[model samples]
Target: MCSNVIRRMNEQQLIDGCKRNDRLAQKELYDKYSRKMMGVCMRYVNDRETARDILQEGFVKLFTNVDSYLQEGPFEAWMRKVFVNSALEYLRKMDILKEAVSLDQAPEASSSFHSVLTELSAQELLTMVQELPAGFRTVFNLFAIEGYSHKEIGEMLGITESTSRSQYTRARQLLQKRIGKIL
Candidate 1:
């Protein structure tokens, strides 16, 4: 039996214990990161139930693939990537990205629009993002929040670069319109 208190285990210790298939370590890992990962899942999916499903699936994938972790980067970042990929896979399986459109000229958000975003509370911003249609939300999260390039998002979602750009643009426009109502 693992003698270390799960709560006291550092990240590296957790990773090592998980790699050794210690149940306490796995539970601690999940307890430590599940909420954050759930937020990541929720950003992609609107409903909590679906987000929970994705969160569970992400944890399963993480534990299964723990041995593959190279320890070269921050473990949280690596775990986040796994959860994000899991969410993307769920979206793909549901064919949610099929609605994404392609536009040759995607307009950028104005400087004033960005300033408006800064005025909102984090919950308000999150709610606005959650209200976006799935395609827009997914693209926006990938391009803006996750810091993935349009080309990278395109490759990940199996859409063209123009489509990713178009979705991101549309998402921003929608969010701006929503924010305008609050001002």
Candidate 2:
């Protein structure tokens, strides 16, 4: 199909075309989703270069594994999930998943995050999140920013739900401490 024709196609058809190895179709898909998917990748990875790397690899999976996508939801949203999972997987492979300071292992959760959060803008929050060590940071992003439940975060990172909760607590604690320092 022509580039214009490819661009006009809805995502499922674009995905269907990609499964058939249609170059124009895949390019169209990439052009459509890459920006938003990059945002998602950046949230998880917290580094532009690494997030871009994840975005490229995630797109590779999108093209190579297009057949695995279910016809269950919006295609862009599906692709977002794929890229999100892939970003998480990249963190896991890098051995960053186990750093969650278990609540039991961490000092008690403080009300510090709440005290300081209102003063920060969205970008400020993102920066604070980026400053967290990997385990605490990833869980915080998934649960707090991305809206994943503790159970989902646990499953994705291979930790318990309580661990996810505790890690989230610790992440907030760290954010509080760091932001407190900045103010």
Candidate 3:
């Protein structure tokens, strides 16, 4: 039908339609970004079902706030930030970040761990990351994957920068230990 044909919009058109609360455009946008957004959610939560919830919640928030989008960056990047923040909100609600150990309790970083990581496939690496404790996984995903600084992660997660740094260090160490067994 011509209606369906008209619904196949480009990114900007989808954004415009979403801003106008167009259902077709919202569905199109969800279809386009859901998988990638789900991956982002999974990186933080690890559980598929919870990630699905976050993905849905992220879309809701994205649609609700689309009017505030400044159009200063790539639309996909903005979408990712929304999904990541949604995941962080879930984590905060669960109080998972409270499990983060202090910097004093963290182990020394292993330089050799860097070389082991280079050998892993992305899936392998992701699996190892998913195996981390919730606190460590959140910090690692934010700092390493999302490219946020510890200060920013701390501000977002309501943790201190040092706590974020320690959690990230511990995450790397745990991944290295896991990779050692696989190798």
C-alpha local distance difference test of each model: 0.86, 0.80, 0.85
Q: Which residue pairs clash within candidate 1? A: none
In model 2, the clashing pairs are: none
Give one digit per residue, the lDDT tens place, for model 2 in 53-106. 999999998899888877778777678778878988898799877764544545
Residue-wise lDDT of candidate 3 within 1-183, one digit each (tens)? 996787657899999999999998898999888888988988888778998899889999999999989999999999999999999889889888677555565555555756667777887777778888899998889998999999999899887999788778888877766776776
For lDDT, candidate 2 versus 3, the one ahead is 3
Ranking of predictions according to lDDT: 1, 3, 2
Candidate 3: worst 10 consecutive residues by lDDT? 102-111
State the TM-score for model 3. 0.88
Looking at model 2, report the run of 10 residues with the lowest lDDT sum. 100-109
Q: Model 1 — TM-score against the truth? A: 0.88
In order of listing, the candidates' clash counts read 0, 0, 0
- Compared with the true structure, what per-residue lDDT tens digits does model 1 show for residues 76-169? 9999999999998998899886764345333445446667777788778888999887899999999899999999998998889998887888
lDDT for model 1 comes to 0.86
Q: Which residue pairs clash in candidate 3?
A: none
Q: lDDT for model 2, on a 0 to 1 scale? A: 0.80
lDDT of 3 at 170: 89
